[model samples]
Target chain A: MMDLQVKLPGLNLKNPVMPASGCFGFGKEYSRFYDLSLLGAVMMKAATGTERLGNPTPRVAETSSGMLNAIGLQNPGVDKIIAEEVPFLAQYDTEIIANIAGSTIEEYKEVAKKFNDAPEVKAFELNISCPNVKEGGIQFGTDPDMAKEVTTIVKRASDKPVYVKLSPNVSNIVAMAKAVEEAGADGLTMINTLTGMQIHLPSRRPLIANKTGGLSGAAIKPIAIRMIYEVREQVNLPIIGMGGIETAEDVLEFLLAGANAVAVGTANFQNPLVMPEIINELPKTLEKYGFSSVHDAIGKAVFV
Target chain B: MRKVEMKLVYARQIAEDTIEMKLEDNYITQIAEPGQFIYIALPNFTLRRPISIADVDREQKQLTILFKIFGRGTASFAAYEPGMIVDCIGPNGNGFPFDTDKMEKVLLIGGGIGVPPLYYLGKKLKSKGIEVTSILGYQTAAQVFYEEEFNQLGETIVVTDDGSYGEKGYVTDIITDSFNFDLYYSCGPTGMLRALTSKLQDKKGYISLEERMGCGVGACAACVVSTKNEQGYLKICHDGPVFPAKEVIL
Candidate 1:
């Protein structure tokens, strides 16, 4: 068997597979299905300064090959996570990446400061791409200046590496990715859900209560692969590629697209054990392709 | 909590839009408590749909699920017949809490598809020698189901919203008029559950809430409910899909 480890700048993952933020929910529930420690890392749900009730009912809608969600970053606030969730997650062997989201830069600083004190959290994934919330969602990622400012502020507040998650809703994703990288971000998680909508025929109204939502799953993989390739060309920083990764083949595409690491998102909704399956399959895929390690596959297909 | 593979032994249509599926998965049957649900996946769908366990035969390692065909995914499920292979992840989420030794009399109330879970709970309570009274509500006589099965378990009452069945009006109205019990348990649409909670506010009971869930596990916070807890929110998929009435806001 071949080694499939990939080093992402300051971070070192056992394999390229990770559970995307919001989808994995901090890894506790998934532990029941399989040992979560087997995965490379677990991204906690996007946390804020206060508990959020999230959007109204019918927060999700089914799309053609994917689904749309407007969960509005419903979290147990930074205080509760530090006091409750972190301590429990500390027991797991996998890397714990605190995914932070906020309505303002100060709130982002406050969350980062709390994680600074907790030894359990290895890194922070700044969620500047949540499209559901009215404030600090896609607004921050769409503007290069706002993205840089927020990233710099969070970077200064935390001692841990900061990975800024970029939204695909913007016109120039490369510009936004470069902006965050210049602001001192350690890496980037590319292509959060794309903005989309669904309508109910009988009611003659939108299917989602929030009207518009972020689309994810298999439908967005092609776009995500293209974006990862684009970002990899412009930025020197490592990229966490994700969108509609459902199988090992999908993970390979992301690696070949220059993602130092890959996060499993909507696939977890289809199969909770998807991360493990991808992790176990990567080494086999690597050997068959005549690659010595997973890192060799990174950017392999980008030039082609 | 072992992750065991289950095979779909048979799937048969019980009504016009209702399908009853039986799986030969023992982990679910042995570990699943009444009122708990299973998340089933269709080969083509991107997400899994959760359906409550209607019946469980632990001795035979069989678990039955009753589902109504409401959309594309469910409609596809209806096409599945006996021996079709299907995947299921469960018995996830908490189930109804009942102490038969302590509570002598129990009331099981359900509305529409909500009636399915109560049937299982009533059966368990009956086995423990607890007096069980079941009230099942539907829209009309034609839509009413499982009245006979529930009757076999305990004293059963039927109510239809259009006055086309045993008792006219809502299930709560029937509960107010006919039966009295030490404890109550219910599952239904949010409106029905809220109405019952308000009518029986001073009383104590457990109510199961239905919400759009991302992960049927506790992690997503998608199935959160307002609670009296300091955190103010609780994961229905993990904490208690079955919550005490007082803790729930509505």
Candidate 2:
């Protein structure tokens, strides 16, 4: 039997495939199609201190081989998620990774600290890279100092391991990764969506209501591989790499580029069964490339 | 909510810029309801297009959809042939509320592309021995479609914006107090729905909505709309594409 298991900081993943944060709501919607336990871990949507209404309609627009979305982190504050969503996920065997985001450091720490008591939540994926919202998100993401500060505060407040999610919009990704690592982040989730926009030709205005949104899907895979390859050499932390992953081949590509595990984002919108389909195919895919196991392939393409 | 690769049984242009295609899928045809839509995955497009089920033939195991060439995604359907396959996830979102016993003289008001699902609902209601009247509005005579199909079911009215068809005005112009309906179902532009709901307040009605969607499964929260409910919001892709006209704020 092939070993598909992978171990990140606080997550002992049965397989390297899990849905990216925002794409899979709270696991309630998708539970109708398949079992939630089939996934290695469930990355809950970014939760803020207070309930967020998100942006207006037409928040999503299709691009070349990707899509742009400005969902603006529309989540029911941390209290509701912990009270309702976490307990529902606790029934499943999969690990739950809380993705915490906020407009202020106090809010971020508060959200993180609240989840520490929840036995279902195994770790925290610090969301400093969400590009859709007006404040906190993308602001801390683009700057090295802000990213480091948020990571430090959240890490200090939370009992579970904290992984800093990195944004691709930064000019110096290496600097950002190193800053978070120095701030005592346990792991990293790299290559958040690139900032992008689309225009409706007839209206002569932006298609997305936010005018700008985060671009994700198959089109952004190469950029993810390149970034993971760059960061794996310098940053001494496990990575939960994501961006445009569709097939099992994409999972193997992410692993070889130094990702300990992979999260699928926009591809879930394409095929709801995508994550499990990729999980079933991972063993054969890993063997086809002459890798014995998932761990055997991590960073195979990266040079020290 | 299952994924299947439906084989196109036939593809033909039913109207100017509008094409009608029939796909064969036993699973979908068996479960698909009147107002529910299928999210189709085209070859080159990143996002799936949510098209309503115009009609379903259970015995033949076929589903039909009538779509206009609105954009590049819809235009891709022009290349599909009878033997080709289309991958899609279906019978998604809440269909039109047909369980109510109050529906007697049912009125279906649809405009532009919104007329498709109403055709299915009209057929179902007619089979139940209920009186059905349809007012289908189009931009012009060239844009009109399914009038004959709807006419066979009951009294059908066709109106065009340019007076190039049956009547000169919108569907609302023909909706007078003389046409008494116990229950009504409407699918059209937001403006038409808002006007119709306000004009016929305190009456029981269901409205089908459209929005740019992702996931089409209520997970992405990309296609949510505000509601008067305590929750303050609902997802258009899952909670509805069909909703009680009164439950929605619009």
Each predicted complex: what DockQ? 0.58, 0.86
Q: Please identify model 2 stretches exceeding 4 Å from their true place.
A: A302-304
lDDT of 1 by residue, A1-304 (tens): 5777767655667877889999977677787788877988888899898887798657777777899998889887899998998887778777888999999999999999988888888889999999999988678989999999999999899789999999999889999999998999999998899999988998999988889999999999999999988888889988889999988888888888888888888888778888888888878877777778887888899364
| DockQ agreement of candidate 1 with the native complex | 0.58
Clash count for each candidate, listed in order shown = 0, 0
Chain B TM-score in each of the candidates: 0.95, 0.98
**TM-score of candidate 1 to 2 decimals:** 0.95
How would you encode candidate 2's per-residue C-alpha lDDT over B57-159 as one tens digit per residue?
Answer: 9999999999889888898877798999999898899999876476678999999999999999999999998999999999999999999999999999999
- Give the top-scoring candidate (lDDT): 2
Candidate that scores best on TM-score: 2
Calculate model 1's interface RMSD in Å. 1.8
Q: What is the lDDT of residue B82 in candidate 1?
A: 73
Tell me which residue pairs clash in candidate 2: none
